[model samples]
Target: MKVLGMLYGMAVGDALGMPSELWSREKVKSYFGDITEFLDGPKENDVACNFTKGQFTDDTTQALLILDSLIENDFIPSEKLIAEKLIEWAVRTDAFENNILGPSSKAALLAIKEGENADILTRKALTNGAAMRIAPIGALFSTAQNKELSEYVFEVSRATHTSDVSIGGAAMIAYAVSASIEDKSWEQIIEGALNIYELASKKGAETFTASIPERLKLGIEFADLYQDDEETFTQKIYDVIGCGTMTSESVPAALAIAYYAKDPNRCALICANIGGDTDTIGAMATAICGAKYGYDAIRKDWIDTIDSENSVDLKNYAHFIELHKPQFKGV
Candidate 1:
């Protein structure tokens, strides 16, 4: 149930935040007035305008690509399989034509289509594209298997985003989810994520991007400082931590907001309204939230809506994950 909870939570968050993606925090507030329910994307926001209510954006789609690849590979993370799955999804969904794909992923996949090596092509591609679709990596690896987890993350994420910040942010989210699946409290998950971030950061090629670990620390501080002022917490996270496409900003913002919300549903709500890259942030954060709380914590109506509205069967993904989980290569 918990394994499925992680997937459902990611989908829920993605849909919850779909309409608000790419909008600034101020614009989100001015236009939507803090998202409480799923709404269709308005014509004003170019990135989100095409999506309808209860529809998840590319974040969830890409996450499922990873899961599908893993399930087919007997739960082993294969870079080649991941790349192939991504290309298939992009073409099938018209991701490139629709402008739904993230910038870094689009560039890398395009290079791959031209027979260029994705590893080299993604050398400087630093964005949350890797982190946004990384929930499965967390659920696949255990907290103690940091070495294996980092290797798997690098292999999968480097196909699209190769920078230290990008890979590390993806690992950070995965590590937090691993901790959550182990029933760790949000505090423990935060600590575990930071520790793994340093290890994972050293694996990828260094880039000019800001350090995800350092920004994550600041996010924690921001979370603490805003405890007495819950009303301004989202705004503070938006300004200081940011909710941008950069791996450094969105991943840490997701982690901090997840910790602050302390519940899957609340995490979805708070992140949905946080503006810039909201769907990615929400997907990442809420997945971690669900790992801790499991199925019972989520509302039944939300589950039914996500099942009916989305294309993928979240339960089938979860079932496959659970069935093959014993064969996970992370350990």
Candidate 2:
């Protein structure tokens, strides 16, 4: 139930946030998108967003593919096979074109084109690329008895993000999800994530503090632009973070949503509505919620919003989880 929730919840949240992902508050306003609730869109420049209500984007699609690979290959994904599968899946499903890939992922794919080792390609292209699709790693390893779960998470994260910060960010999300499955409190989960970030920071993660004031101001400004000062809390972290491509910007923003939003759907919706990197933020929040609540707890209406009623295999995913349980024997 926990694994099912994390996977499916991420898909649901990713789909919900797909349309408004790249839209600015202004652009959203032009589309009668004042309300933050999930809405349908077939807007231009938003290919995946046009994927009908309940249809997931690359976040969920790539994540499930990774999960499938891990299950089939005994938790050690072969880089070549992984790349081939991703390309085939992208072409067959039409989720992405050649130009739509993230920088890190694209770099790794290019390495594959040049016949480089998959592991080498992954380790060299440290980016948020890997972080976006790691929810299942959290779910599958939820029962890790020793600290081996963290090490295992680092291994998976290093496939695409070897930098301490990126791996740390991935580990934070992975363990947060795992802890959620164990029914850990929100505070505990946040602290766990903080611990990972602190570890990475101490080990020389790059600092983006110069832009933090601007980002904090920007965050607060945006919140005020939409929500009155009394209703938003963006000002509190003004000195601590900034918004940018770095893990510091991305991860903390996602955690902020999980920390503040009072409910599962609410958390995902808030992250999506806030705009920048919505899918990733929404994915993270959904992962945490799914870990905490399990699959059945997610609202049925949200599940129904998924793009396919007849397709997508939750049961097979469940089977994968069952098969991997024995690997935890020694742990």
Candidate 3:
């Protein structure tokens, strides 16, 4: 049930924030005020303007590709297979030229299409695309040891985002989601995520690593302040940590918000209201919160809305993850 929550939570957050992605905090406030429900992307939104209310964007769509690839390959998709599926999805969904794909993913996919090695092409690319689609990997491998989990995170992320920064962001989200699914305490989850981030930082991009611990600590501090004055809290987050698409900024922001909110709906709202990269941040935060609180934690209305709008089956993805979970040899 919680697994279902994580999957649906991703879509719910993605849909709720779709309209606001790339908007500035001031612009978002001027327009939507505060996103409490699904809304169509603004006419000015170049990428998402074509989407209807309650329709998820590339975040969930790409995630579903990862989910399908994982299930079809029995939990371990090679880089080529993952690249093929991503390209296939882009073409099939007409995202190839729709300005829908992220810069890093678009470049990597193009490189793959041109016969470059997926891993080599993405080695320098760093974006939230990998992290946005990483919840399923976390949920499916919740019980694996941290070392094993980190390895899997690397393998999955390297298919399209090879930067240590990007991989670290994805690993942090993955470990947090996994820990939440295992019902670990919030402290434990945070610590586990930090540990994964530390390890991942050692190998890849070194840009964001040094500041993560401080950012996370700041998030906790702000969470305490959030209860006193919501407006000030939001402003503080915007001014300090940011809500942009950079893996460093958005990933930590998502973790902080999820840690602060601890509830799926509130997490989604916080991410949605923060502006840039709203859908991706909302998806990451709400997925972790959903893992914590279960599917029932999400608003019934939101679930119904997403179900009516999107074509993919959330439960089917969850079921496939469950069915394809790794079988440990000497557990």
Highest-scoring model, TM-score: 1
Candidate lDDT (C-alpha), each? 0.86, 0.61, 0.82
Give the TM-score ranking, best first. 1, 3, 2
Give candidate 1 misplaced runs (Cα > 4 Å). Answer: none
Pairs with steric clashes in candidate 2 = 54-305, 54-306, 54-307
Q: For model 1, where is the 10-residue window of minimal lDDT?
A: 322-331
lDDT of 1 by residue, 1-331 (tens): 7878898889899999999888887888999887888889899988888888888989999989888887887776787888899999899888888889998999999888788877775878778898999897788777889999998888878778878888888999999888999998778899999998889888888888777778788888878888767668888888887889988889989999998887899999998888889999999999999888998798788888888888788888888877766777663
Our tally of clashes for model 1 stands at 0
Give lDDT tens digits, candidate 2, residues 59-146: 7777777776776777775655567666667567543453345666666655565666555555444446666777777766653332
**Each model's Cα RMSD:** 1.4, 4.7, 2.1
Q: lDDT by residue for model 3 over 244-286, one digit each (tens)? A: 8878778888888888888899888888888889999999999
Question: What TM-score against the true fold does each predicted structure earn?
Answer: 0.96, 0.80, 0.94
